[model samples]
Target: MNISEQQIWDLTNQAIDKLGANASPDMIRDYVEKEIANRHGGSLPTEKFEGRVIITAFGINKPGIVAKITGSLAEMEIDLQDISQKIMQNFFTLIMIVDITSSPRNLKEVQEELARVGKELTIKIYAQHEDIFQYMFRI
Candidate 1:
């Protein structure tokens, strides 16, 4: 029921301690993996987003920017799954993950509309597939 990454680390430590100081590294790793799998059924179910789009916007900080950006999504029937925005000095940065599978408009059309909005708002908006985001940020 929603265990955090830190909690998982703590639980792994406790499990390893129970195996005593002489426990091998491989044994500890295996034990922790199995314990976590047993608790969570190996993987957590997630909502599938076929047309997942990541949008990043940055510009001078001002009011109503969020409402305007999200309003565009609403008009297109796009689902805004997650969003985060921050302001540093007079600059504003926003990142949003949206589900565009159900949208009536195509990806090109959506990006074009967003570009129009960006120009109007004096902000730069970029829209790309989620896979690209994952690849570029992979460690």
Candidate 2:
């Protein structure tokens, strides 16, 4: 049975509502899987789901920061799933969710590249697999 994107979204929304602010990534994932199994009378679909990475950077505000970072990701064929950034005065913080399944480089390579870029720009950047990130930051 094929599940539409809308179905996934609805399931995700329901999970969020049920779990509220205490929900971790693993919790949501498990909730969705259980819901799908209950509704479809089987396990999740056979489609492969690639792991994602979380990228975070922060430093004094400067021009071309986003451009440079995104450009490097593009060069490595990384797909940006979502991004949020905020700048206050001279400081800025950026967070991004990226899919590196298409990239020729692995997570460590990506982190090294981003670290180099951050050093060049005098900022701080960190990358972690979503699972590790979620585990480390669980509420």
CA lDDT scores, all candidates in order? 0.87, 0.89
Q: lDDT of model 1 at residue 35?
A: 72
lDDT of 2 by residue, 46-102 (tens): 433357998999999999999999999999999999999999887999999999988
- Among residues 3 or more apart in sequence or in different chains, the pairs in candidate 1 whose N, CA or C atoms overlap within 3 Å are none
User: What's the true lDDT of residue 39 in model 2?
Assistant: 85
Tens-digit lDDT track of model 1 for 1-139: 4679998888877876788888898878878777766777775333444679999999998888899999999999999999998999999999999999998777888899999999989999999999986888996
Clashes of each: 0, 0
* Candidate 1 residue runs with Cα over 4 Å from true position: 1-49
Model 1 lDDT, full chain set = 0.87
Q: How many backbone clashes does candidate 2 have?
A: 0
Measured against the true structure, the TM-scores of the candidates, in listed sequence, are 0.62, 0.61
